[model samples]
Target: MTSGLQQKNSILILDFGSQYTQLIARRVRENKVYSTIVSHKITAEEIKKQAPKGLIFSGGPASVYDEKSPKCDKGIFKLGIPILGICYGQQLIAQYFGGKVRRTREREFGRQELFIDDHADFFSGLPGNITCWMSHGDYVSSLPKGFVSIAHTLSTPNAAFASRDRKVFGVQFHPEVVHTARGSEIISNFLYRICRCRPSWEMGAFIKDTVSHIRQLVGKDSVVCGLSGGVDSSVAAVLIHRAIGRQLRCIFVDNGLVRNREPEEIKTIFRANLHMNLDFVNAQNRFLKRLKGVTDPEVKRKTIGDEFIKVFEEEAKKIRRVKYLAQGTLYPDVIESVSATGSPSAKIKTHHNVGGLPEKMNLKLIEPLRELFKDEVRELAKQLGLPQEIIHRQPFPGPGLAIRIVGEVTPERLQVLRDADDIFVGEIRKAGLYNEVWQSFCVLLCIKSVGVMGDERTYENVIALRCVSSSDGMTADWVKLEPALLGKVSSRIINEVKGVNRVVYDISSKPPSTIEWE
Candidate 1:
């Protein structure tokens, strides 16, 4: 099934094309209720099939007054499931069922106080006058039939509304966003108290279930998995290898996208622990030779993606009777329908997906960790008794430093960036910021600037340090690193790394900027 979360206590998020729609899913998953995000244009027939425990309407960019605003049919309301709507979702619910949406010139674009009324099911254990993140242009002035107002802000009188009989709830402010104090608790209240879903969604059960399912699916057939030594693929390899034992063939592709000593380190871990049939394909020359002079980002992505598949295919031909190809794809890579910045088509870089193979490969797709987020995958890995070093490792792009280099993939540039990145990550660990950041890396910019290192003019490659704190990789804020820490990191990188003279910190958030530059 395309809906990967079918077997769990699911929360269905009918995406209203909101940037934070995925955030709603992340929040639900945090409550241990597996959630799926489907397009708002989905018919009621589709909603009926998923059989969600609860329904949530996500906020969108569209105003309720738009002639072509996104909305779901009223028939979904009658599904007898607990429904909670956010921002534009609240407006949609109110507009459809005898509520008035007024366009206010004053926009509540940031934090707002929620004065909670105790007479509702939504505010079970939450306190009154709590702050929530608000981002909307329109406000719901009137309530829908059988829906009474339970909470309000200074500007929004109908901030929250509910129907006692129907078990419907709506909130004008986004509880999914982090700026909202006690937002997670409110979301938890909806999932546990309101919908009453079972809390059986832990990692231990997931590992057991996935292992069982993999055993059933592959039987005794040989499966080839690409192990990039990143958490995703490494964890996937460990899980699948544990289930199938000798049947799983792991191909560690040293695409030269890896850091110095990475291939050696990966070989050590897999060989020592799993002891399965491991093949190391040194495709660095192939990848770097193909990526030479590729300046355009999309072109680089396509070239890398295409070349990766070809290498994988070539490697697959060597191993006889390998009928399945496994990848370490996660939920964020699949669940995200739109970028958080509300950009055009949400141009995705092809670091993770080697662009799903053509018909000729004839390999059945096996993604054991497809349904899980990265953290959950780590948890599953831990349950499967994988080493802690492999489990707690930070995320590196499938294309590795190639994407981080920004312009082209060259051996010279890669070496410099690799050293700098190593130093940066090493120093971060020394300062104890490794666990705090979801991802932190050094970007090797193509441009070089003049710098004075001990009274000598040196024009060298520039490195941009990016460290963002995020629960999920969905929405993120730049980590407020201390000046002394930054100074130490900069001094170490400039002195130790031969590639560059300059070190810059990225202070941009995810809306106008993504974690990765390319």
Candidate 2:
């Protein structure tokens, strides 16, 4: 049974392999309306069963003219519900409605000015011209029979089009991205004016509903949570505890892959302070033994996931009457780990918790926050009266420092990276910039560099610092740290961290590079 999320006021997003598909759902949720993602190959019969208030077609990298590009069922348009298409999605709408979409000489890849011709129906209350984010090579040369060009950019003559009578709309530029001016307003007009959806979804209501659902799901069975002391796990533990008080037990595993002194600190925060039924497992040797010589990221993740299950299975057997295993799995973990059926979305990386779906397990899995984003989990934490330290803590991956190191998992490499990362985080916190960025850490690059120390040339490991700022993990931009702060961090890591000679800063964004090195 699903929670109260699949309701009448929710929006359904058809995923066509766009990297920004999750962003579209986040935007709709920000409007306080629920949104879900499904494969574009889903039929109209399947769509009718969900009874979505509106449908949104996400932009993809493929062109509609390609022989093998992904496409949705054409019969979905007959449902008579409002639909909006963005970027490549617009190409499909144009091609299906008797319009011509042809390749342009040059692709528009950034912000452009869109001149609005009519602001009555689709482009309501907007001014003459507005800046919009454009990233497409194809343009609609001609409009459909009933569709009108509501807005146009210099490069794309039909930037935005609408068919009021058919309750269909298409925009060549992306409104979900912040690069476009008044992008949220454009989405708001579509959600309220076009779809007539209510702004009724909120975190408080979710907590109330989830607690009850968890109680019903786990009647008298004891539940075990793998607590990492991060916001997601903390929120999940607290929610489960509220449902079945003493029946919930949290296990904090010291896999020797976490930050320096993290295991003890987590124990202090949870066991000593919160006073929940907790277990501390020191399985560092078990994890390291299995992860030795594993270089491939997927292999490392799956190995760690397998080890975690084995450890949990042993621990659950000790805790009598336990039948449910819970973890802090979020939406991004599920999205990036698994691909939709018949969708072109690529699997970026495998999260240890989500990558290995339940296998050889006697206990059933329960994830309360699987449908929520990182920021949404933080909000849920605050609503649950969690302390600021827990609610505002930076995100940490389940694979931990294994993913931070570019190569094999060894005690020496882990220590070197840990020392460098400790210095980086310490400086950021001392400068009062710790909370300003989404995530800030140090990576131990696989290659080494030659440097001079005490009048002698020596080769040592190079440490790379990655820091990004973002509202959500979907899209990210590197944080422009101060020069003095960078200099201090570099000097401290070189002096304090053994085997690290030089420190470099990574300035790449999410599209070209991920936050982690591995």
Candidate 3:
């Protein structure tokens, strides 16, 4: 979704480059109030134009005393809206209001106990003692004018302060993170009582508005959806079809990198169940030709992405008037491509649909699920009456099995990976753990290991099984499979699939290791 929408009664979060800035927005949205994240350097006029009912200053990494620290327009406080500052945001508020802030001798990095004071509406329904998540080195030394200490920890005396007259509040601990007990309740108090915001936002309303918006954007113009039989594209295609019924055409390209029988399954489902105009393109030779000797991950992604667009352009020529190209680009793709807060973050990897596309293309882009997380999209898919099979399908990268192979793109390697992956997933389903884990896949390693099979020395390729449980793809933890289950999978893979001998499970989490091997 674009940032230009004029959502009414929304909350504006001025991001100060915190890693948890997006979490703040997610928390606000969870409260059923629309929230948008913008750079801290946004001008006062822009804030006035958005006309938010509340303002939230997100936590940041920089100290407020630094000259280069990110700052918001001073005039924002004069907007007469309820304000809540978090972590570094609290320091900025204190410094702006004539309070002293200095680096503390000991930094509070993890969970800490907070002793609450008699602040009327700030801590309305909370107990005397609560746990909070704190990650800051600096603390407010003195209270600002007309503000009283609402809460404090052992080391941090002025942990939280509020000014009832000015409708301003500050908290040194992060209430957006799950580590803080009753964090949602505190945020709910701010939204419902302090900001006086109504809980009007829901997925149903979002669907209605997005459909209307899409219709308005593509007036009498045909749109083409690159359907990959995945949840994201399936939801996008169905939503766009709901808006412009006959003008939407779906193209399913089999690049020969997908799982077995995916193309035929997608065709049958879309045509028989959804009753939409669908086309199947067999460009496996085209994709494999361009990816003949490519070993670099980025090059493979770019080649696959560009080849998809070229194929789409060729198909668009056959259709009547295809002006817009629809994709199911989600919030994580945008966040990973470039930091949403305009801060410096390491580039994880390029999503084919997000960053690998060419600069210039024939079709304008239309992404309906851009602002949504994966779980939220699943909810939308369910609301739209999509079948359980599509709604609960495991997430597959846009580049398909190409990125799953570590070394190079070749027919022999692809077949080996495909067979092993099928067996792994089939076992997961048989164990009734398919829906329990977020993603379960097999990665074909480039190296080979020596093994004695039936008293014969043999060298064969090794495969790594990656199964992770995550609320969202941003962070994930490896799933701990039962020993019996693991043994079964290992035995089946080693016994069934040829050209491979070893099977191992990955135990790495997201921070040190990504879900995908590449």
- Poorest 10 consecutive residues by lDDT, candidate 2: 1-10
Give the distance in Å from residue 64's predicted Cα in candidate 3 to where it truly belongs. 3.0
Which residues of candidate 2, in runs, are more than 4 Å off? Answer: 1-6, 340-342, 357-359
lDDT of 1 by residue, 235-312 (tens): 888888878888889998888888879888988888876676789988888888888889887677667767777877
Give the Cα lDDT of each candidate.
0.80, 0.88, 0.88
All candidates: TM-score: 0.91, 0.95, 0.91
RMSD in order of candidates: 3.1, 1.9, 2.9
Best by TM-score: 2
lDDT of 2 by residue, 1-518 (tens): 23455487889999898878888888899999888888998899999998888999999878899999998899998999899999888889989999999998997787899899989756788889999988888888899999999999888889999999989999999999877888888888899999999997888888888999999999988999999989999999999999999999999889999998898888888888887898999999999999888899889999988888888989999987999999999877877887643578788888999876456677889999988888899999989888889999999999889999998989999999998988899899998988888999998889999999999998999999999998888778899999999999999999988898999999999766877766
Off by over 4 Å in 1: 1-8, 41-51, 65-67, 104-108, 336-351, 354-362
| Candidate 3 residue runs with Cα over 4 Å from true position | 1-6, 100-120, 123-159, 340-346
Q: Return whichever of 2 and 3 wins on TM-score.
A: 2
